[model samples]
Target: MIEDDAAVRRGVVDALEYAGYRTLEAGDGDEGLRMALGASYRLLLLDLVMPGRDGFSILAELKKKRAGQPVIILSARGEEHDRVRGLELGADDYVMKPFSVRELLARVEAVLRRTCERAAPEDKRMIPGGEVDFSEGRIAFEDGVEEALSEREGELLRYLLEAKGRVVSRDEILRHVWGLDPAKTETRTLDMHIMHLRSKLRDKAQDFLVTVRGKGWRVVS
Candidate 1:
């Protein structure tokens, strides 16, 4: 946990400890960032407004170095933009200030559960027109054509294939694959990536990757 308010931080830490959780805490942004980057923890509780290094900076660094890190933002900034910004910076959830202990604990539990449920990524998968070798970042089509995949494209395809049977919401893809906030309106990038993936896979008919209107994308067998 990283919080500047001493009383608030102590209260939260005490509550978490009482609930059978061991915690490491910091009262300022610089120390918090250091601990956050170095400490081994299942989840991170971060304060957006802090002295020295703010939560946004720390979040950006984590996104670059530890894309899979689970983080929840705690802030008194209740504006929609603040929440959206935190999420866009790769926070898993946002908890506003003056929040209840119960609510905070519930958010923590939910984030931890979601993180734990993510399966290990696969290095290769068989697609419709070819086999995607994620390790090599390339696709081998049946007609003997080969296409290279950018790192982002490879990760996106791998995520979709992992959740093959169901429609994955755009927000979920953004959070899990791009580390972007799902609530952000700029999803054109995601759409473009999907289009590129489809082209690379030779899925012009959309038989392999199907977009469910008002929902998300799904990979069909």
Candidate 2:
């Protein structure tokens, strides 16, 4: 996860973990880039502005140093040129600040899903327990059991799995999963749902949720 605001960082990181993902976090573009390169993660969540390197420079370095990795820019750079420039500089996608969680998850999911299927075609999706088929939305666990998920859980899980390796943001989650318009409501509601999801899935596979300090959730390897 990459973000500057301290408050945003905490909320986002918690949400990402509760949602079942592993994450790496950075406060600015330079740190984001360093973490991105130093790690062998499947996804990169980047911020454009920073104390030193800035997002644009980071993107350039990411492309130059780690050509195969995919990048998603999360920043205040909502201007048209900024978006285009990010893409041109090898950023796979861009998300402006004050973004919607629904949109963020959707974009993150689309990028990771697409990339995995393209590069690791043979083992792209995880078939947990021979009962839990992530892509299929059906689980075939013990007792030869199989079931469908509620609409919201399905969406949340989908997004988590897609990134699978980085903390997702809270604003991103609320906007994306609940489609909640920005409001004054407490964020605790998200925690309840995550607990429920965690309880249900833990028995079937390796621990999925990892709480990244001051960041969001990620679904990692």
**Which candidate gets the maximum TM-score versus the true structure?**
1
Per-residue error at 147 for model 2, in Å?
A: 49
Q: Pairing residues by index, what is the TM-score of model 2?
A: 0.52
Misplaced by over 4 Å in model 1 are 119-221
- Per-residue lDDT of 4 in model 1: 96
Report the C-alpha lDDT of model 2 over 1-221, residue by residue, as the tens digit. 77777777767667666667688788876677667656546788777776777878887876654554688888776889989999999988887777766677788789988777754322224434434455565545565666655657667766666665766766457755676643434568776766666655653343566666565677755
**What are the TM-scores, per candidate, against the unseen true structure?**
0.57, 0.52
Cα error, candidate 1, residue 141 (Å): 16
Indicate the residue-level lDDT of 122 in model 1.
78
C-alpha lDDT of residue 122 in model 2? 24
lDDT of 1 by residue, 13-115 (tens): 9999999999999989899987886666789999988898999999998775555689999999989998999999999999988999999999999999998
